[model samples]
Target: MDAQQVFALLCIGFVLAAFDKKKEHFPLPLLLLAAGILCSFVPFFSNIEVTRDLIFDWFLPALLFVAAYQFPYRDLKKDAGLISTLATIGLLLTFILLGISLYILLSPFLEVSLVACLLIAAMLTPTDPVSVVTILKQTGPQEAADIVEGESLLNDGTSIVLFTLMSTMYFESQQFSINSFLIDFLLVTFSGAAIGLIIAFLANKWMHLIKDNEYHIFLSLLLAYISFYIAESLQVSGILATVAAGLFLSRHFHVNGDKEVKERLDGFWGIIELLMICLVFLLIGIAGGQQPYISYLYYILAGFLLMIAARYIVLALIMYLIPFWRHRFHFQDYLILGWGGMKGTISLALLLGLNAGGKNSEVIFTLTFGIVFLSIFIQSLTMYPITRKLKAQEQKKKESS
Candidate 1:
């Protein structure tokens, strides 16, 4: 489809979704996924192709920046311990457990290697911030939501590091060295963070000099692209840099001078987000349709089981280590946390970026997409119910006291 047609369809979808009060029943992503699938059935629409350059260069940076800019820095700081644990140690545990579980499950049927399994696990490790934060704003507790957002932000960087390392190992047939891995991971993360900090500091210092609202808004948008580009050029994590810049700008730049400008910027970005959401889900559905469903039926089922088992095991381990978590967050809270870690566009993008000639590339991509689809549809839809129940239980306890 041409850009105009794509934008038109996206606008229609956004309007329908925005006006519909029953958003809980048919979330935006699910709706977009359905629309994409339905559209693909048409002859003309079937030819629509989503390019990696569009996603990596245009959409991702914008999405990351918006998420980062809107995120409350002070609230994130307050729950630093919980967020840190979940994003870092929690992510590592999830990757290891999930990787092992998938390896064991797929070992008998397919000659799935450990490295390939790890790559898949790493790809799905980071939860999509856009979906989670949007949902959390409505259903989760204030403190819990902040922690969730913070964890999501940091986990994206961590997951990319793990995914990049595992992808290299799989394609290059390289042996794993702890020292080398740690050094690479640390360097990527630190460099991304540093770039973000520098951009934020400079933006803050100069933002006061700009009096025009339109110009200020433009600067914010430009800053997002600059951060991502600079980070990528430096061989650091562009995702991390975009996020850091967003957070920095949000905290430092005030929208007080012109309400109209602020509103216009918000509206413009809101449109961008909706279009991106539709494009992403559309790509996901198209990718899903390309796979032979019957061939991977058993593998998909096994993957589902493995993911759940891994999540529970990891949660149990984390809870055991930090007894305070058990007291602070109940069983339902843990369950929601595990389930809410739904994989989305980032995972799909990474899968597509994998070398097609690499061994097990097709199988890995198909299974990854299937696993991610199930995670988003089943887990994301049910997360709010679980969280609501947990919140009710907490409220009851407080009332009794």
Candidate 2:
């Protein structure tokens, strides 16, 4: 297919997703993923694959920029401690334990190395901000949603940095040491933020100088791609850079601009966010279409259990040990937190990005796909009910008090 054809289909995908969003029964991500899966079998489009470059280079920056801009920084600041703990410590523990436990549990049967297990863990660790924002709006307390979303926003950078670290260790045959890991983690995190801040600062200045609202809106589009590229070029976490730059630029742009610029910026990014979501889910479905699900049933089931159990254990420990968390968050809210760590497009992108080491690669990749599908489909189905129960309990407590 020519470049033009691909763009045309993406346009169509956006329209389809827009229409589907109105239907309460089918959430937009699931709907598009399903559509992509069904479309995979069709004779016309089966040959064309959505390249990893297309997704990474284009789709992701747009998604990340808009999400950061829309995020309530004030709310995030208040819950910084909990979010930081979950995003850093909580994520690291789950990623390590998930890999180690899976390696132990599936030991003799699955011929995967410890390093490979760690890589798998890192890939699945980051909660999807895209999914976080979309689902949390309908359920739970504002604080709970803020913590989860903030953790997701920050933790994605952590997870990706960890993923790169693990990948390097495995590929380069380097020994993993705590001191080395700590130094590298700090380097990646700080570098990403610095890069973002600098770019966003300059971008803001450029926008203020421009009097045209249209140019300011379009400049945001460039800001996303530029920040991501510059960060990646410097060998740091592009995702984090994009997040930081977005938070700053959005605030700066809104403060300096007239009403028209703010509205235009919001509208343009809004369309891009929707389109990115649609295309990502669709690509997930298409990528997953060729897998032998029946043959890989055991891996899928086991992987799902391992991921869920790891999350449950982390939540339990965090709530039990932290007095503030224990007192502030209801047990039901804790349950929601455990189940709410849904994986999406980023997981798949990482899996595809890594060097495949023969047959075992397929197993790990398929296991990841299973986690993502279950996260979006099975877990999402129960979310509304869980939130309803939590809200009801919250209301009752208010009445009783």
Candidate 3:
């Protein structure tokens, strides 16, 4: 679909959502996804196709930027230690466990080598910020939500680092070297951050100079794409760049501006997010239509199992090793951590980008899409109940204390 049609559908969807009582109970991602699926069945709309470039180029940066822009930087800093551990060590643990499990269990019928399995595992490691933040908005107790958001933000960088390294190794049959991996990872991450920071600084300065809300609003949208483009040109992680730029802009803009600027920017980004959310989810469903149904079913089931089992094992191991985390961790937190790690567009993009000759490429993509769907719909819908129970238990303990 063209941009105008997409925008119009988004307006209708948002308006319907605003009026629909059922939407309030379900996660917005799930609702948008359903709309996309419904659109696919329509007589003429079945032929609608979105290219990978549109999603990667037009949608991703804006979505990531808005997410980063809205992030509470101060809260993120306060929980940096916990968030870092989850994003880094926690991610590594999950990756190794999931990769090994997939290789062992699905190797027989899947016909993929160990490296290919690892590549797929790494691709599915990142959590969807769009879904997580949507869930956070529905649930109260902002503390737990902040932790999930912070982990999701930082972990995207970590997951992408692993994905790039592993994908290179798989496709090139290159041997592992810690130094080589570190060099590439650091170059991408550091360059992304450096570029994003520079752009954010310049953008903020320009906004201050203009001292006009309309100009600031338009510039903010431009800043999102500019930071991403610059990062991509530098051969860095453009998504991370957008995130960093967003957080920096959000913090500096608040400190430098009055309430009106903040309000205008808030409304502006909200509209951007609403439009992007629909487009992204629609893109996701359309992407899924390319996969054959039969082959993907088994792999999807296997992926679902591997992802969940690996998550539980990682959470248990981490909590056991870290006494502080053990003390703080609750049953519901464990459940949410495993379930809330929904895989979205990032996974879909990587899966589609997989070389066609790669072992079981079609099967792998189908499985990846299935896992992504389950992650967003099943886990996202259930997270609220898990959080509610955990919060209630915590309250009970407080009363007893």
Best by TM-score: 2
As a whole number from 0 to 100, the lDDT of residue 11 in candidate 2 is 71
Which ten-residue region of model 2 has the weakest summed lDDT? 17-26
C-alpha root-mean-square deviation, candidate 1: 2.5
Poorest lDDT segment (10 consecutive residues) of candidate 3? 16-25
Clashes of each: 0, 0, 0
TM-score, cand. 2: 0.92
Ranking by lDDT: 2, 3, 1
TM-score of each: 0.91, 0.92, 0.91
Tens-digit lDDT track of model 3 for 89-199: 888888888888888878787678887778878888877777777666566456666777777776766777888778778878889888987887778877887899999
Strongest candidate by lDDT: 2
**Candidate 1 local lDDT, residue 274:** 68
Q: State the displacement of the C-alpha of residue 247, model 3, in Å, after optimal TM-score superposition.
A: 0.7
**Model 2: per-residue lDDT, tens digit, 353-396?**
77767447777777777777877887766777777777788889
User: Which digits, one per residue and each the tens of the lDDT, describe model 1 over residues 194-298?
Assistant: 898798778766767877777777887888899889999999988889888887766653533345655766776776676677676766676566676568878
